[model samples]
Target chain A: MPDRANDPTDALRRVDLVLRVHDHQIVGPEGELLGNVDDVELAEVDGRWLVTGLMVGPAALSQRLPGKLGTWTHAVWSRLHPDREPTPVVVPMEHVTDIGSAVALDEWAARRLARTLGLELWLREFVVSRIPGAKGGSSDERPGDLVESASSEATEAAEGGSESEAALRPRPDGRPVSGLLGRTGLSPDGERLGRLRDLWALGGPRDGHPEPLRVTHLEFTSHRLGAELGYSADDRQGPALVRAFFRWLHRNDRVVPISALTGIDDTGRTVTVETTHMRHPFDQ
Target chain B: MKKFFAIALGILTAIGGFVDIGDLVTNGLVGARFGLSLGWVVVLGVVGICVFAEMSGRVAAVSGRGTFDLIRERLGPRVGLTNLVASMAVTLLTFTAEIGGIALALQLATNVNPYLWIPVVGAAVWIVLWRVKFSVVENVFGLAGLALIVFAVALWQLGPDWSDLWRQASRPLVPHDESHTTYFYYAVALFGAAMTPYEVFFFSSGGVEEHWTAKDLGVMRANVFVGFPLGGILSFAIAGSAAVVFQSQGIQVDTLGQIGLPVGMAMGQLGLALVLLGFFAATFGAACETGLSVGYSISQYLGWQWGKYVEPLRAARFHTVLLLSTIVGVGTLLTTVDPIMLTEYSVVFSAVALPLTYFPILVVANDRTYMGRHANGRLANTLGTFYLVVVGVAAVAAIPLMIITRAGQ
Candidate 1:
C-alpha cells in the first residue's frame, strides 16, 4: 500500500491501509464491526497499483483526514478516539486484494500486516485458538450475521398478550405453542424461570385449558443459536461439543425443556420460561 | 380493517416513540432558550433521519442485515472499528439519560425522590431486557409513549394566539433574549436532538430484529418516512408549548416537572397524568433501545455471538455488556447528576459523533457492490450528499460551539 505517512500539518491527504473482509461499522470506537464496506482499495503496494485498504468513512467523505485536523472532523469519531485508544484509523496495506464497491481482502489483516507476525501467529494458534471452546475461524468467515439479533416481534406479542390477559385463552401468537403460565419450572441456566408461551382461547367459557395456546419462546431464533436447529436421538451435547471442534460447525437447533413451561393461564402469561438450562425434550 | 387500523396506530405510536431522551432533553432545552426560532432545525433533522433510516431499513429488509451489519460490509475493519467506537459512545450516553429519564418520570408521578427510584427503574429495565419478548417491549412502550399528545392538547388549551404562535414559528431567527453564539449553540442542539444517534441505531436494529426482508422495504420505508417526522411533530409540540408558556414566564425547563408544566397549564390533571405516562414510556423505551444498540454494535463488529434471540448464557458476552451498561447508567444517575443535564451532554456529544457514523453510511449506501441493485438512487445520493455537508460542518464546529456556549448555558 502507498505508505503515505500522513503529516501532522498536511490535513487533506489520504493514506491507504489494507482492507480485511470482515470490516463493519460499530456504534462507537469500542463496539464490534457493524457491517462490511464493499469498496475499492486504491493504494500503491510495492510499485504496482495493488489496491490496499478499502475506503470507509463518513458518507460525507471517502476517508476521514487523519490526526488533529481530522480531530475536529466528527463528533462520534472524536468521542470514540478521545485521547484514549488513539489506535490510528488504519489497517495495514497487505490484506486487500481487489477493488470495486465490494473489495475483498485477506481473511486476516493481523496475519499479513503485523511486523511481528510470528508472535501474533503463535498466540493465535496457542492462546486465541484454544480459548475454551472458541470458534477458531478467521474473523472474516463469520462476518455476516445470518439472522435477526433482537426480536421486537416477540416483545410485542408478549405485550399484546398481557393487555388481553383477562381473557383466559391459549397462546396469543399463532403456531404450535405449549402453555407455560402458572406452573413453576427450572431455567435452562438454572436461574428462576419466567413465562414461556401463552396459548390463546379459541372459543370457550371464561376458563383455563379450553383455549388454544401459541408458543413464543424467549427470542431463540436460529440467529441466536448461531446454528441451524436440528435435534436427533443420537444428537446430544456430547456430540454437540465434538461438532464444535470444527470451527465452521453450527447446530441450529437448541434444546428447550418440556416441563420448564408453566401451565397456560387465561391471563395470557407464559410463566416459568427458561433460556439457559439444558434438558432434552426429545430424550424426555 | 382492524389490521389497517393497527398499522396506522403503529405508525402513530412510532411517532411518539421516536422522540427519546435525545429529543426530550434537546428540544425542551432549545425551546426554552432559542424559542421557535430553531424549529427548522428539527425539520431538517427529521428529514435527515428519514432518509438514512429508510435506506437502512430497506437494506435490512432486502439484505437481512441490521444497520451495523451493513456498516461492517461497507467499511473495513479499521474504519468500521472507528464507526463502532463512535456510535457506541453516543448510544451509551443516550442510554444513561434514558434510564435516568425513566426514573425522573416515575419520580414526577409518585412525588418520590428520583434517586430512590433509580435502582428500581434500572432493575426493571434490565429485567425487561433479560426476559421480555422484544416486540412486547417495543410495540407496548411505543404505543404508551403517545401519552405525549397531551403536549398538543395543552398547546390548544393554553390557547396561544394562533397568529402569534404561527409568526414565532415562521420567523426563524435568534431570539432577542439569547446571543447569536448561544443561538447557534441551541440551533445545533436542536439539530442534534432531531438527529440524535440512538434513533437511527434503534430504527436500523429494529428493522433487522423484525426480520424485514427486501419485500418488507415498503413497510420499513413507510415507518421511517412517516414515523420520524411525526415524532418530530411531537417534539415541536412540546417545544412550541414551552416557547409560548415558559418563554414569557422566563422559566427555562431545567426539570422534568417543568417540562410537563405546559400540559398542566392546558389540560389540568388529566393532561399532566398523560404527559407523565408519556415521559415514563418514552424514556423507558429509549433506555431499552440505547442499551441494545450498545450490545448490537459490539457483537456485530467482533463477529462474536450476540442478540436477544440467544439465551443469556449462550450469548454471554453480549448479555454481559448489556447488563454492564444498565448498571453503569444507573450508577451514573446515582451520582446525583441531573438526568436532564446528562441528556443535554449526551445530545451535544452525539452531535459531535454524527459525521463519523453517518459519513460511512452515506458512502456505503451509495456503493454498488454490497448494495448491488439496491444502491442508493439519485434522490438518496443527493440528499445523502447534502446531509454529509451539513453533518461535516456540524462535526467540525460542535466542540468549539460547546465550549463557546458552555453547553448552551
Candidate 2:
C-alpha cells in the first residue's frame, strides 16, 4: 500500500494550521466519530517548533474559549476529573493518517482510544444502550484480519520508538496554539506591530515518514475580524463585494519568518521579532 | 425510473414540508389584518431562503460538514458559541411551538383540550425520532403534509375576486386602520417564517445525513428551486383564503381552527378534515425537523457525533441532546402558554437571529478550499449578497418593530 504520509500532495504543506486543522472533526479510519482538534500541542525540538500532538476534550477546548467561559469550563472539567491532576487527551501526531474534511486517525489507535471519551461512554452505558433499539444497524463487528494487521502495525510503530529516541524527543510543554494567538507582536525596538493572528506551517518528509508540520512563520494583523474568513489569501475568490471587504480589512496584516522571531514571552503575552524580515502577507 | 421517482419524491416532500406552524400562524394573522399587502415579504423571504439554503446544502455536499461546523470554523470559538446559543434558543423555541402546534391540531380534530395532548404529542415525536429511519420520517410526514393542497382548492372554491388580492399584493399599501409600524412588523414576521434558521440547519444537515455528493446536487437544486416555491404558493393560498374569509369581516386569526375556518366555510367538513390532516402533518414534520435541528446545531458546534443515520447508541451525545430538547419542549408546552402566541414570538425571534446563521454559510460557500470549482458563481453571489442585506435589515429591525407595534397588537 502506498504510504499516505509520504504522498507529495499532502494537505499540510504550506497551510495555515489554525485555519485548516484547528476545531476540525477527528474521525477513525472507517469514519467513526472521535472528537475534534480542540487544541494543538507545539514543542521546540532541535531548534525547530513542530506540532507534537492534537489535543481533544473539554480540558483542551476550555483554553481556546474566551475569558469567563474559559475559566468556568476549566473549573468544571477539573472538578469532574477522576485523577488528582487532569490533563487533556492528546493524540500523538504519528497516529494521524490524513487531514482533509476531518483529521483521520489510524484504525487500531482510534478504536482503542474512543473508549477514553468520558461523556460518550457514560451516556452509552447508562442511557442510550438501555433503549430497546439503540444497537440496531450498528456494524461494530470488523473482520479479524484487519484488526490483526492494524494492531501489529501499531505495535511496530510503538516499538520503533526506542529509549534513546525518547530521550532525544523534547517534552511537549503545555504551550498550545491558542496560547500564541492574540499575543501582541513587538519589534526588537519595543514597537508594537500587531496581534499574533495565525501561524503558517510547512510539512516535509523526514526520518522515513512525514514529519509533523513545523511552524515557519507568524502572522500579525491589526484587525482580527476576517482572520479565518479565507480572504487573506489572494487565490480566494468569491462574491466580489465580500471578498473586497475582507481584503481591505486584512490589508495591513504582515508575516514574519520564524528566523526573525527572537523570543515568545508567555508571561507577558508578547512575541518579539526582527522588523526587517516582516512583509505583507499577500506579497508573493 | 428510479431516479425520476426520487426527484419527484424530493420535490413533493419539499413542498409539503415547507409550511410549519410559523408560516401558518404568521400568514393567517397577516392575511386577516393586512390583507395580501405583505405578500411581497413572503416572496422576498422564499428567495432569500433559496439563495442561502442552496449554499448551505452545496457546502454540506462537497465539504461533508454541516452549517454549525463551518460557523465555528470560520467565526472561531467565541463568536461561534454566541451564535450557537442564539440559534439554538430560537430553534428550541420553534420546537416547543411545533409540539404545541401538534397538540392544537389534535384539539381541532378531537375537540379535546390541547393542554392534555401536549405530553402525548411530545412522546410520539420522541419515539418517531428514536425509532424511525431518517428517510421514512421525512417522507411520511412530508407526503402527508401534501394534504395541505386543500388550502389552494378551498381558495378556488371560495371564488374570491382574484384581482383584488392581486391589487393588494402588487400595491403593497398599508391599510388606513393599521399603522405602518404594525404593517412592517408583520412583514418581518412573514419573512422570518419563510426563512427560519432551522430550515437551513435541517436542510444542510439532512444533506449530510443522506451523504449527498456532487452527483446529487442536481436533485437537491430541483428540490429547492421547484419544491420550495410551490410550497411558497401553499403559504400564499393560506393567506388568500384567510383574507377572503376574515379580512372582510375584521376577525383576527388567533387560533389554528380559525386559520382553517375559511376552508371549512368554503368546502364544508371534508375540506376541514384535509386541512386538519395538513395541519397535523406539517407541524409534526416540522417538530421532527426542529428537534433534529436543535440536536444538529449543538452537536455540530461541539464536533460530537450527530445525525439519525448513525445508530442511536453510536451517537449517544447527539441523542441525549435530542432527548433533553424534547423534554424541555414538553415542559414549556405544559406551562399552558398559547401555541399561536409562542409561534408568533418564535418567528420574530427567528428574524432576530437570521444574520448570525446566514453570514457563515455565505463565507464558506465562497471558500475555494471547501467548494473548489463549485464555489459561488456571479449570479449566485449577486443573489446571495442582495439577500444578505435584506436579512440584515430584517434582523436589525425585527426587535424594535416588535416593541413599537406591541407584537403587532
Candidate 3:
C-alpha cells in the first residue's frame, strides 16, 4: 500500500508498482481511443518502469481490492463476457492520427470504441430511420458528424483550450453587420471607442434575419483593464466614471451608436466596435 | 428492440434525473401545505424543463458542447468566469443538499444520526462515479427510485374526498394561513427544484458522455418528455397523500417524517416502511445525480476529459473535484445544519440560478450554425422563449419573496 503520511508527491515518485495489459486502450477527448498502450507500470525509487502486470478482464481489476462487490463484479464480468479465444485487439501508437493538446486516435481505436460503445447497433437498428421524420436515410449524413458541429464544437473547444487550431477552421457563414455594433472604444480625441457585450436576440422565428445581435449595454463584470488590474473598482476613477456614464446611457434597453470598428477578431470572441462616443465631446 | 432500449435509456435518465432531494421534500411539503394548488408549478416546471432540456440536448447533440462551454464562448472570459462562479456555487449548494439527503435517508432507516452516515454516503457516491459503469450507475438508481411511486398507492388507499382535493389542485393558491409571500416563496422553490441547473448540466454532459448524435435526439426527447412527467406524477401523489391527511389536520411538513406522515397514517407500519424505502431510494438516487453533476460542471467547463467512461487515474482532475466536493458536502451536513433546510434553500437558489444556465441553452439552440436544420422550430421557440421569461421572473422574485415571507414561516 502507498504511504499517505509521507509527502504525496515524494511517495508518488517512490511508488514502484506498475501494470500493463495489451489492448488497454487510451481513450481521448471525444472517446477517441489512441491505440492500445502495450505497457503501463508506474516507476519507483530511482528509475524503473515496466508493463509489470497484464490487466485484461474485470477479474484483474478486482484483484486490486478483495471484497464481495469487487469479487462478484469481477466474477460476473468475466463470466457473461464473450471471448472466443481472445486474441487481444492490437493497434500500435504509431497509428495515432493527430496528437496535440488532444490526441486523435486513428480509425482503429475509434472503430473499436464505437463497437464497445454499442454505436454500430445503435446506428444500424435503433437510431437511424427511427425518428418520426428523419431525412434521406443515411445518404450524406456522416456518423462522426453526429457529434461534430462545424461552428460550435470547434469554437467551444478552442475557447477552453487554445485558439490557434480553431482559427484555421472555417468561419461561420454569417458575419456581424454594421448595425449590430454598439459602443466603440476610442482614444480621448473623439476617436472611435470599442464596442461592449453583444446582446444576442435569444429566440426568434425560424426564417427572416436569424436574430441580429445588437451590441447590448456594456457590462463590466471584472475591471481587467491593463493598468486597472491591481486597482479595485473603487480605486479607479476612469472605469467608475465610464461605468456611471454607461449606467446613464443604458437606463433602458436602447442602442447607442459610436464610430465604426477598425477591426474585429472572430477567433478571439471580441469585437473592436470602434465608436466616437468619446469620453470627451470637445476633443481634437 | 435496440430502438426501444435507447428510448428506455432516455426514460431511465429522466427518471434518475427527475426527483432530486429538493423535489422529494418540496413536492411533498407543498402537497401537504396547499395540496394540488402549488402542483401547477411542477406542471409549469415540467413544461419549462422540457423546453430547456430539449434545447440543451439539441445544443449538446448539434454543437458537441456543454453549458459552461457556450457560456464562456458567448459571455467572454470575465463574465463567463462570473457566471461560472455563480453557477458553480449554486450547483455545489445543490450538491451539498443532495449528499445531506442521502445521509438523512440512511438515518431514517437505521435510526443513526445522519451525520455519522455523511462520510459513508459521500465515499459511496464517489466510488460509484469512479468505478461503476455509467449506464449501471444511472439504471440502478433509476429503477430503484421507482420504488417511490408507492406514495401514489398510499394516497389512493387513504380514501378521502376526491372532489375537494381535485378542486384545490385545479385552483392552487396561497393558503389562507400562510401569507402570499410565503406561498410565492414555496412556488419559486418548487419551480427551481423542477428546473435545477444540474439537470441540464447532467443531461447535456450525459449526451456527450453517451456520445449522442442528432439521431439520438428522439430517444433523448422521449426521456425528457415521458420520464419527467412520470416523475411529476409521482411528486403529485406525494402531495395528494399529504393533502388528504395533513391539510385538514393542520399538520405542516418540517422534516422527512412529516412528509411521509400521510403514508404512515394510511397503512400503518407497512406504508411507513415503503415511504422510508422511497426516501432512501430517491435521496440516494439524487445524490448520484448531483454528485455526477459536480464533476460534470467542473470538467466540462475546463474541457478536462471527464465521465464515468474513463479510468480514475486518467481523469484525475475530474475525480479530484468529485472527491473534494463530496467531502465538503459531507462536512457541511456534519455541522449539524438541517439537511431539510438545506434542501429548501437549494430550491430557492435553484430558482435564482435558472436564467444563468437556461439562457445560454436557449441562445445556442436557436443558432443555425450549431443546430443546422435541427434548430428549434416556432413551437419550440415559443415555448422555450416564454419559459425563459417565466424563469427570469421566478429568479428575480425568488429572493425577495423568501425575505418577505421570512423563509416562508
Q: Pick the TM-score winner.
A: 2
Q: Where is model 2 more than 4 Å wrong at Cα?
A: A1-12, A136-171, A204-210
* Model 2 error, position A177 (Å): 0.6
lDDT of 1 by residue, B1-409 (tens): 9756756766876786887877877777677766777888888888998887776666555544566655654454346667888888878888989998998889889989999999999999988887677778888899998888888888887888788767777887677778888887777777777777766667777776666665666656767778777888899898888888878778878888888888898888888889999999998988888898898777665444456654343355566678789999889889999988888878878888887667556654543334555657778877877887887787777889989988777
Q: Choose the strongest candidate by DockQ.
A: 2
DockQ of 1: 0.04
Write out the backbone clash pairs for model 2.
none
How well does each candidate superpose onto the true structure, as a TM-score? 0.62, 0.93, 0.64
Model 2's chain A TM-score stands at 0.81
Write one digit per residue (lDDT tens) for candidate 2, span B308-333.
88878678899999999999999998
Count of steric clashes across candidates, in order? 97, 0, 16
Instruction: Give the per-residue lDDT of model 3 (tens digit) for A155-215.
Output: 3433544333222221222221212223343333543334442221112111222221122
* Per-candidate DockQ vs. reference: 0.04, 0.39, 0.02
Worst 10 residues of 3 chain A by lDDT: A14-23
Question: Candidate 3, residues B1-409: lDDT per residue as tens digits?
Answer: 9888868866865664578788888987887777788978888998888888888887777656666666544443345556777887888888888888878777777999888888888888877765677777777777777767778888888887889888887876667887777788889999998899988988887787777788777888888889988888887888888878888888888888777777777778887777777677777767777778877776554445466665443344566677688888888888888988998998899899898888767655654433556766778777876887899899999989988888888
State in Å the error of residue B57, model 3.
1.1
Compose the digit string of candidate 2's lDDT tens values, residues A1-284: 12334322234357677887888888887767788788888888788888877888888889989888999999998897554555677777777777665777776558655645667766766677776666633266432333344335444434654332232222446478898999999998899889998888887333325457788999999999879877775345677888888778888889999889899897999999998878988785
